[model samples]
Target: MSTTTALPHWDMTVVYPGLDSSEFAQGLSQVLQHIDELASFFAEKQVQALPAAPVLDDAFVRDFEQVVARYNAMSDEVRTISVYISSFVNTNSQDDLAQAKYSELQRGLTLLAQQATRFTAWIGSLDVEALIERSQVARDHAFPLRKAYKQARHLMSPVEEELASELNVSSGSAWTKLHGNISSQLNVPLKIDGETKSYPMSAIRNMAFSEERDLRRLAYEAELAAWKSNAVPLAAALNSIKNEVNVISRRRQWESPLEASLFDSSIDRETLDAMLSAARASFPDWRRYLRTKARLLGLEKLAWYDLFAPVARESKVWEFAEASNFIIEQFGSYSQRLSDYAARAFRERWIDAEPRPGKRDGAYCASLRADESRILANFKPAFAGMSTLAHELGHGYHNLNMLKRTALQRRHPMTLAETASIFCETIIRHAALGQVEPSEQIAILEASLQGSCQVVVDITSRFLFEQNVFEKRQRRELSVDELNELMLDSQRQTYGAGLDEAMLHPYMWAVKGHYYNTGRSYYNYPYMFGLLFGLGLYARYQQQPEEFKQSYDDLLSSTGMASAAELAQRFGIDIRSESFWRSSLDITRQDIDLFEQLAAQR
Candidate 1:
């Protein structure tokens, strides 16, 4: 019942009670000395012994693990400091020293990367299997590290690898930084209610969900118009980055940018193919859902802006306390472990849920060292924002599940990472639908359909854009016109017969920051892959609600160790088989049909 105007401030002192703590300074000094020792040892000779192998059972192995443990402890400390500084900058961008420290920390990371790469390459030459075979934790970790070495090793000769690590501080990484500056600096000039106004991309985009159709339409038009002014700069950055990917992929003898991405993700080709096949097959059902949505809004056809437009009688104000309780209770019914995590997340002040000025534009959950997670959000206390909260809590739960994992194995692939978060959102929303009145049910259904379209349609468009752009960049640089053309073409293909073509967004590629990562290519498909995969898992949950909980928890916990296909195999599902994806789409289609029937009955 309370709407607190000010968001609660996080206490970073939980990690380090004071910046000047003797404990921290001593730990830092110890870690730096260890790194110095490692560089000294490796620089002196080729590896005669492996590092950190408990199985080796000699004085050298003991020395190595002790140093590694200390290094890891310091690594965690540095990351925690960087995270706190970055989060502070997100809320207070005007803090020049915070920004400066953030930049310095990133540069420090690049230097650390060179050191780490040299050590890893040295370790790769050793008989790692023998050492790991002696220790269970080491044995469990061998494959993932081996995979990393295999991917990066091919990309450069020993000298080139070392050089690239050093030069990354200035070249490809700099272009990404330039791209971020352009986006963060953009301002949209608009005419609102017969008055001239200026808006940020974040503010104008949020207007697409305004209850007033006139406001939504005006905001959409004004937003698109403003992007025209900065499109050229954004396009150049895209071309430069894509060109960088093409050049590097070829130098490394990679078949394609996508191949590099898949290799890095540790997912096989057949598995990815099956995920795409499932998404394409469900287009008809999604289209049907779109039509139902249009009819409910009394529009002849849906436009891009209208897709997220709030439908009347579907708008509801959900109090934060009630929403939190609802999510906890529903998730508890699914698994007590999940419920306990959610409960603690809220009670422990782990979540920053209130909307405020100077806060970052989106939501994220940052997993801290050893059994802790911090969630940051600009909460509006609406149904949609609550869903975002629940979605992020799902991420917190994943962190909790993987708390015991070593830092190295804990970094799961992006595609598999979405499983728990989306599953939590589904559990909460679907449960709310069952308990709501018919009108409210209609609203809930609308929101669900809207999200499904984003994963399927919007994500497909991004995938197509990246694919074509990479191909074109391989041949030569694409002009702004060419990029715009590709963006529109991709939108038409994915959003076929659903969206008003004239209203399609042609500057989408220019705006989304996902494309700016130099090392990570084809970041688009992961969202679609994650969504459908989670939906497939949700179907299993429905079939045997009691049995699915433990297996689901096990799946999240094992993400650090397994591939997408391997994880699916544990549930008796073959990810490479198209039929498994078909089943997930079938569930989505059923929902679309139900929405249509409900609309018709009304």
Candidate 2:
């Protein structure tokens, strides 16, 4: 087997030289000055008449436009600093300076939020329709303005909102940061080749994809032990974050935490229900796939840790360069624009793919601004790692499509956020299936099916777990043992008899970062939405290979501006219908059948 490949470190020169650089200092100063200026403008006597304006006249429009432009400018600068610092921290989570800058940035953002709330409240009090029709600037910002007006109902007084934001920096966000630091510092002890060695959680977790079953099991046990060691503090962090969300959400007059999440997702309850119901109906098929995987591994029942264990004995490893070239080639086969954008990302060093100590776990693509995005991944040479690279590159492709839009218009909801990345992943996976030998085909098929199961099956479990947490958390703080039981119950409900009951992962809440975010509740369902939605789009692309290219780009570009239902309608997809979701699941069903046949032959 090849040793761990040397991964690429992203170039931060585009934002600044470093945290200590003069450029960074100047940028920070400029951002602070901009914030103060905006705050003063909001406090001006002239702005006092904003809410009482009876007519949408030229003067009113001009003043509003100026405020909007300044706000956007301030936001742009803050976002640039936020992205750079966040990228640095993602790769070096233990850096005290980065953490300090992050906290400072949060405070700066709170000040901006105060100004923005006052401004938005004034705008919301206006005749928005007339403003949009009369002013071209308002017309350009119609969607965001309209959304702000709708969301204004939930906004507290500016003072209260500002206080909440500031308090979160020390309370909710502080707890989250503590959780991250603890998780990053953890060392999982595994006995490899008769010698006990300690590995970081991220490194050890990757061993789940190893072909060696013993290694996968050992790593899994060690990871569980590590989590167990920190369970008490992690549980406190989870409870505190969720409780903060509950308090603030109630103060905002949201019907429920889940309702607020749905509003934020730009998806309706009916659509979410339809999609989740479809997923539940498909659990039988998912279980069949799992059972097949267990049989191939010579186990009567698969454990939770065994879920990611490789079924293909002939899995091949791709070097970092090989994976990059392959991803570029696969993207080119679909669209030259996507291919070119990915090539630029590679050439410009926009990706940080190295696996090292102090780096945050998992992969993500951060949109620094409209024209730039930074991708971070812990790249290994295995097929799974290659797929992860493709996934993040897909996110870059989505950002590229939205580059021409305004900053506010480029903010897509979480439901539509996963579309491009998952679509890109499907593209490469199918392409691989066409080229690989039969045994290798099993590896590719297993990898693809395993990914679908995560989105469809595992995400459902997470969604259920979070739902239970919120329901129980409202009554009282849950103990560590109670949280574990809730997690195990959710898994059983979602995974059914597919997994061994004895070996389930109970500390999942401790490891998953998604649950810790107070701002974004119920972050699980979006993966299911993205996968099914992307597959539905991919099915259309397969049907009309040439014509669907533009439609795909159009969909990606519109994601930031339209609702998920509206975007689906452009391609004649009815997301609220169960049939649409089932069609996507049918693709997974076919893959499972193929896997079963291959396993029988083997």
Candidate 3:
């Protein structure tokens, strides 16, 4: 628990001096004006209500290019400030100004949503291939255009879509806000030094990684109690968000909410099915790893609190500076560009790594302008800490590679989004395992296995839980108790004999922010997708390091332009094949075998 040193706060000043600054105000004003003008542009160009097969003359082609180009340009302007406000809101949950500004910004997004619906609806009737040939902008945006057209099948009328968009600000978005505010501000009671003290949820969560078993147990109990206390609103938020998704999903003529998510993910149902099948088959292996970990901890079965309890033979505390250097050096082994990008991110203070009360939990990198990204992390001093840095910097590097593309072109789906990050994480893990001493080897290998299990096993539980919630929510609102039961059931199904069933986490539905997001469903599976997909790609990179670099960069850059299957094809990997996924799983299976051998030695 050597987390005394202060982690660096990112350089937000570079984005904008402050919320009240002239530039910030101008950004807000500019977006408002652009949306208004965009609406006018839609109206003037007859962008709404196009004929089933509109005459694609030269004039129409020229006008359509402007429409798509303008929309993309406007999106960049909108995202620049949108991420700025979010960075503040996410970092400081109590930042009233940032919250207010974000709400205000959503209004403009609502109007933009209306315009986008109209545009999407209009594109539905067009000959996408014909238009792609005629307009350069159309060619550049062919993937998004085709996607919008395909999505048009599920959309309501422009009027209905607009109404839904407007209501989202108060319904989905507001409920999500409530969950975040409550979760971040939540202070759970924990006993320390004979005095009961209240710690913010983030601090309590970080303690999960702490080596102290008693402390971890206490934090787990306190966290569950806190969530139970707040479960009413959190459950309401979950219900409302899910119900909204169900309503809209049905309205859009989607067969299921999962189908809509599959669409949004730019991945097909077959691909997901393949991945999950492989994942389910590997569950026993993961359970074996868990059992071995339990044995190492001198227990028969692990409690939920012990899942992330660091298992290291020779433990090392990775301070912020040390972790940063380690990440940089490992990244350099892959590519100097990646190494340099990570170095610059650290040098320029592009990360806010401090774990504090107001700051939210987890780590994510938000692409601000062009290639610049701001990463938020609650950095704990361990192998996981350094790996977290590498993971986020991988995201930053992904953004850097896509710099030549427009904002719309860079808008990749969640399934593709995690690949680069996990790829970087693998780099750090693999490099560290090879170089560390036998004692540290146990530490690094276990840490790596711990992370893989999370993505594979824990994520499977979350996906199952979300599925049941969605299925039941379609009938009626679920009670808090019902949600807990569903969560426990999913955990039981996934973890099986690996964990003490009585000690499983039931409030995981409330703990994860993934479930609270109304815009996306099935956020859990994407991590699994990323982990396996990334492992597969990394394997290729190792065999043909020289040839793989450019091809790999191409795949990352083209993520937004193609489906997951299509991208996988470029690498000669069939995402829809269970064998492909099984191959990826086998990579982790080897590690699990190694871990069991090491555990036997211990």
Candidate 4:
């Protein structure tokens, strides 16, 4: 087994010098001034009326851009401190200063939220089309900004919104703390190699994906037992937060939580349906792959824990540096610009790769002030780790593209957010598959398809579970058992006859944390949408290599500006059409066929 210390650690000071330096402090002070100015202006003038239209006055345009620039620069400093503090906290949860810094930052964010909401509400009240008639750029951006404020307006009655806004600092967001506390602090007592050791749930739960069946089963049982102990409280946290979302949705006049989320994501109901339908249609293929794995392992049926068991006869070892080079080289072949970006990020220590104590579990890529992107991961030096690097690097690529756009324009909808990362994985996976032998190909394919199954089947189940939980929780509180049943039913619907009935994870309602979000409604479908969308684009790339490059870049570059469907239309892909999504799934089906053929030969 690989030691955890082998994981990477990031050095953020490379982004900017000392935070206490004169220049840094000056920038921070300037941002504070801008925030106060904006807050006071909005608070005083915009009572029920929108701020002056930017299009009608050139002075407003210049001032507004200045306002944005100041905010962006300020945000960069704030993010630097946040990334530094959070990174430290993740690795060393015991660090007092890190915790202090984090708390201080949270308080600061709460203030910013209040200031931002008032400004946005003021903006959303303006007649966007009329305002935009005067300035094309302002007009072009009007719809998205107006839509954002409109969503913000739904939080509460102006009075209740104010109250919730203040209360969130201590109460509503506390739900995440509950989930995180249980997840990060819970220890699962595991017997590994005749030694009984207490492994934190975050660390040992990942072993369920191990190639060794006994280890996988042991880990699964232990994880379930640990979570079961805290199931009631977990259920409560989920119920309370989800109910909060429902109430907020109702007050906003939104019909359903799903509709509210889709509106926030800038995606429509039909596109979501199309994405889900395509995923549902692809399950037979996934089941076929699962059965093939079960047959290889000489088992009668596959359980949830066996879903990620390796298929290749050989286990390839990858060191961190080797994995980095492999990913960069593959990405370089597709686009030199992208390759260069990856090179700079790594060379400059922008990524915190080496895992250590107190570092956060899981992986994420966050934008640093829209000027840079920071990637966090506990890399394991396996095929999955390599793919994770590609996946995260894809996010970096996306951020890089969007950074050049306006501050308001830099924010992409959640639905299209995963495009570059998934696309990058597709590119790397296909390339690696072509070069490797059949046995290696089987391993690679299983890993790839298993990941797809997660976003498709598992995520869909989450979508359904959250939807049902929210609906019921609106009227009443559900006991832990009720939530578990809902989770089990959702899993059954998505997995169908593929997974062993007796082995379904009911405590999933307690485990997966996406439902706990107070803001977004269905944080689930976006994963499936991004996967299929990227694959659809990848399919086009295969058909028209050169032409697809420009088109693909253009699509990613405009993610902040266009609706998800509008972006799709640029490539002649109708995202609302089930046929388009099906085509993407068809590509996955084709990959599964090749996987089965390779597995049988092995």
Candidate 5:
């Protein structure tokens, strides 16, 4: 195990010396002033949604461009300051100053949300084609413009929209914070290795990857109990958040929270339906892989924790440096640009790879300023840790290509945002295969399959669970047992006979922070979108590396400017076509076939 003290803490001096520094204070003031400027501009132009045409003249061009310029700069400024302060808060949840700063910034974020909604509603009132024909700026941003215009049909009254935005700060946003603060600080009481230790939830969760069945079982039991004891608050938080989404979605005339999520993710109903249909078709294959694993372990079915248990002859040790080197090298085989960007990230101390008291669990890559990014992870000397590191660095690589785009252009939706990361992960996994021992091969194959199963199968469960929860939330609040039952039913539907029904993780609703999010509901499916979309791209890269290489970076850079289908179309992918998603699922099926082949050797 890697000690927290031994891991690197990220350097944010690239953005500011410190929060108390004059530079930091100045940046904060500038964002405030910019907000004021924007508000005045809105007021001066009487920028409410007009029932008339888009004033498609030189003055319209001037106002739209001016708003774009100010809004973009302000967005970046706010993001820089937000990410900087959050670096400290996320790393040390106990930091009072960081917590205070974050709370202060929430006001700014809320105001920004209000302004954006107002702007979108105003744009929604316009005829998108006339707006584009009237201005060069509009033509350049036709995608978001068109989207805003379409979304206008769903807008509430301006007063209602503003009220909803403000209430979200205390209502939805506060509930999310409560969940984060509690979950991050939660610990499970477990007696392990002859000592009774109160382990943090993340540490306990990590035990799921242990080779020892007893350890995994103990940890699983402890985790469930911990979440159970904490269920009241967690359940309340979820109910509050989901109900808020329901109310807001209803007010906006969305059929469901899933409908709102689709609009937010820049995906269409057809694409999602096709993806889910293909995913359903592949469930049997995933069950075969799971049953094989269970058979290898001499069990009829896998317990929830056994899903990630190592079935290889031996687990490989991976120190942080070794893992970094392997990922960089593997990435280099695919793209020198990706490899070099990764090297810079590590060299510049751009990652905080440590799990410590007060530090949050899991890993994420957040953009700082310009194209620079900071990554956070809980380092472990195992394959899972290394892969997670590579996954996050892939996000950094995405941000690297996002360099020099305006704020709006760089703002990729969740569906497209996972593209570069998944692509990079596939590169690493592919490189590992065909170049290792049978034991090592089994290990790699099982790990890869584990992820695919989650993205395709487990994610389906989450989607169903959340969708049902959202629907039920519209009627009334649910008890913890209800949430658990919903979760188990979802798991049973998707995982089928692969996992022991009795051992299914009913508390998964409490475990995943995704479900607690008020804004980004149905966050689970985007991983599926990314995985399938990325796999399809990887297939192309193999067939035409040179041709694919040149256009790949451009595709990532323009994620914000195009719809998901439009981006896929540039590369001859029809996202709405069921066969397209099936092709991606076929790649996973091949992995299952290889796993079956290798299991026979054992």
Candidate 6:
């Protein structure tokens, strides 16, 4: 529909001219100095050990609050430094200086974290509710304080905690970084139009969404071969990271790694179980959709590679400028606040949309500051790419909504992180469907359904794979072969008869970066959570358009301050109930029904 010769790149000058800039150096120095100041203040108070006779007088509470306030201030400054360095490295992972600076900042942050352990441990020993009631500052930070106290049992001694932090720099973190380096540099061999060429794994993977079936199959085969070549080292990274998590979780007295993840997610086992059960129940509808898709493509069964193949012959190619304007307009129709934020993001060069060498494969939106958010994506002139832009911009909009809150209050759990992003994506997608010609409806519907299936079916498979990996890692280290087997088994169970058994992806674990994070386990289900939750909210909006906007805004604003369950409760949503999840899945089912009807017409 629209075309452009060049896409946009982020203006990092707003952050710093370079890592060598005076501002960058000064920021790092200030962060270190603040950490030293915090360490000195706590050490002077002799707060490193548990007090034999604890007292909570007015003077003590005032001084404690002052220290906490100072800590929060310091934390904000350090976060600014961390966010800039992370953004730089994410887009330039191969840069040695950026990588070195990231490591340095990580170590500095770990040291600062070690210094805070004493204060946290002291807080843990105190009566949090009484403290909150007694002091205004404590009341203001009740959520974080109470959470820290609840987590006190899992905290090791200050020395042990520091050692763990230091070890992670070279252990878990290093392994994950190595995996990133390896994956980013991979070149998959694909034969396209009688020419056998070696392309970046990312480019080949993008071909999965191509309109050409033969090309998709070729890309899939090459991608699998590439992963198989590096499976051993990738497996090692996975094993090491999971083992670290398993040991730390056990030492922290968690029942299992999953329990620790739940604690971090601020959700309980009951809620996760309910949501997963609901997901399983919706498998039949998803399978039916898959069958319909296969028939439309003239295949008896769909292969893993065919999952994203375009169902329509004519695909729309949207230019970068056109897509951005459309998204802004669509967002404006819903809320001027959201549209304004998206407009600012594009106008201020907050997004990097160009594809280049040594860049990361996936897309993400980084909240660099309270008021500033940066998005990184590899843009193409396809509907899928436009959807991606909307998704990342959705994250930007979420960050925009949170600009007024404190740093601590702006940090939402992963479970609710995708709410705004998915919501925004859905907005643009449905709007496109409504405006497109009847002949173009199937492609639009297929694209939407592909995303839905990913969040539901594929995410379920990842959850199952990670669960099995954790369970098995507790007994012993799993070999590369075992990991492949486990992944294949998980896929079989999740995809069922919908996907061709002979063509299912066995190297999925090697490709997904989710499993490599040592601090977070079971990082898959949140997609399912975010999608279903957003869909339910979207459905609610349809019922009462006038009232839902403010409610949605309020919900996004409260994400950082409340738990998932608490936030859902604000909208009268019982996230712990199967019926609530079913309501969301029912919307997806309706889309599938429409897709089937359209395919039949074709």
Query: TM-score: which candidate is best?
Result: 3
Instruction: Score candidate 2 by lDDT.
Output: 0.86
Tell me the deviation in Å of residue 148 in model 4. 3.6
Q: Tell me which of candidates 4 and 6 scores higher on lDDT.
A: 6
Rank order by lDDT, top first? 3, 5, 2, 6, 4, 1
lDDT of 3 by residue, 266-287 (tens): 8888899999999999999999
C-alpha RMSD of candidate 2:
1.7
Compared with the true structure, the alpha-carbon lDDT of candidate 3 equals 0.89
Which lDDT tens digits does candidate 4 get at residues 1-602? 36433555667666445444566456445555655665565455443335343343666655554444554454555665567556666666666765665675676666666755655665566555655665566655765666765665565446666677777766668886677667766778999899999887767767866779999999999988888899888878887888877777787788988888888788888888877887888888888877887887788888988887876554666677877788889888899998888887777777777654445577788877555778888777677878988899899899888766765676677888999999999878988888787767787888898898898889989988888887888789999888879989998998877889898888887777677778666878888888988898888888898998877777787888878888888889998899998899998889888877876785
Which candidate achieves the best lDDT against the true structure?
A: 3
Pick by lDDT: 1 or 3, better one: 3
Q: What is the lDDT of every predicted structure here?
A: 0.74, 0.86, 0.89, 0.76, 0.87, 0.85
User: Residue by residue across 1-602, what tens digits does model 2's lDDT show?
Assistant: 45456678999887788898898888877787778888898776244224464576787788878877777777777777888899878888888888877877776777887777776677767888999998888888887888877887887766688789879878888898889888887877888899998888998888887777788888888998889989999999999999999888899899889999998898999999999999999999999999999999999999877888888764567888888888889889998888888888888899998888889989999888766889998887767778888889899889888877776777789999999998999988988889889889998899889999999999999999999998888999999999999999999998999999898999999989999898899989999999999999999999998888868887888787778898899889999999999999999999999999999999
Candidate 6 stretches with Cα past 4 Å from truth are 1-3, 46-49
In candidate 3, stretches whose alpha carbon ends up further than 4 angstroms from where it belongs are: none
Instruction: List clashing residue pairs in candidate 6.
Output: none
lDDT of 4 at 470: 79
**Model 6, span 1-602: residue lDDT tens:** 22466888888788788898898888788788888888788777655546453678987787777778777777777877887887767776788888888887886887777766776777788888888889988887777778778887788766787788789888998888988988887877888788898898888888887767888898998999999999889999999999999998887788999998887788898899999999999898899999999998899999999998878865567889888988999988898888888899999999988876667887999888768888999997777778899999998888878777666567688999999998999999898998888778888888889989989999999999999999999999899889889989998988899999899988999999889898778889988889999998888888898988867887887787878998888778999998999999999999999998898898
- TM for every model, in the order presented, reads 0.91, 0.97, 0.98, 0.93, 0.97, 0.96
